[model samples]
Target: MTEPGDPRFGATHRRFVIPTVISRATIGGSTCQIVVGVLSSGSATQRSQRGELRAELLRIALRGQGLADPCTVGVEHDANGAPALSSPHIGSVSFSYDGIWAVVAISPSEGRIGVDIQMPRRVSPTVLRRFAPDLATRADDKSTYSEFARRWAAREAASKAAGTGLRGELLRTVLPVARAGRDFGATYTVLDGWTFPALSLAHKD
Candidate 1:
């Protein structure tokens, strides 16, 4: 595993392929990698296939991090359904999927990480208020769907990193601006002409 302050610790690398590795960046004290890919329409609803794809994406991420036999690494989930490295323990991980896109994020075990991706869609005021009331109050008639998705992604990512999975009052408590740089990061990107709102959050150990 790479140490916290190693010169290569925070460096990011990228690749464009069927399962594209969007980008990697330093989050908190760990280097976090994000991978994005498309799932066949037929298998999108197959739980087993989705699981396999997530694992494959993880292996690809580990390989990119210079792991010798990434395929040997095991994956297990916690009680909250959060994924983690089960064997040859190397780092923390998170997963998100929307429509046909599957995204996986991995970071050194030093810190907890969470990631989320949302496809473009209309976010009604009621829905927005339920998820992020403060944001709703601040949002005007001009707020775009992408903006709503981004905020929602940020909250989801934060909740995942904290291992709380959108339950209780946590969703409303995670403010967009407060966590923007402290432990939050988000972006909107286009892949194959499809717009995706993605974000990640890291909680330092």
Candidate 2:
């Protein structure tokens, strides 16, 4: 695995997975890559419950590029509401979906990686009211739910990244919006931005 301070993710470091195909990109440039062949492609429930194992496997493969072990993810809901990985080398990796996508990300440095898989769908005020009662107060812009999602995703990712459950860190918990100048929600505000590669696989059944 690549060391935390390797600078592989820096701007000077190439992003082969995004600009070039993973096959063509150098191994180091693709520490993160999407896994294909999903067992279920259209349902978050299937992806979350079933594809999780496959997703981690792909994550391992991505880590292998950096010479790190992708390792296995253990499912244990903590009081904080984030999923936890049993391995230390795995860094902070989290799994999630938007009823349409299965996604994951790893933080090679902060051990605070977070990613969210979201499907493009219409949002209702009621759903927002249930998850985020403070929506009307945050921003009146068009992407209010998206903002909520970002916050929710970040909460989930951060908690999971720290191996803490999401039970304690819900929206109402009132934790800081960011850490070290990095907005832990929606994206990695710490390093200016964060990109997580997702892998999807299908079940033979």
Question: What lDDT score belongs to each candidate, Candidate 1 first?
Answer: 0.62, 0.38
Candidate 1 RMSD to the correct structure: 7.2
lDDT tens digits by residue: candidate 2, 29-104: 2243322122233333553444543444345435544645444445444565654456545444445554434444
- What TM-score would each prediction reach against the true structure? 0.74, 0.46
lDDT of 1 by residue, 76-155 (tens): 88787877887635878888887767887787765677777876576667776775565566555544566666666667
Worst 10 residues of 1 by lDDT: 1-10
Clashes of 2: 25
Model 2 Cα RMSD, Å?
10.5
- RMSD for each model, in Å, please? 7.2, 10.5
Highest-scoring model, TM-score = 1
Best by lDDT: 1
Model 2: how far is 27 from its true place, Å?
A: 20
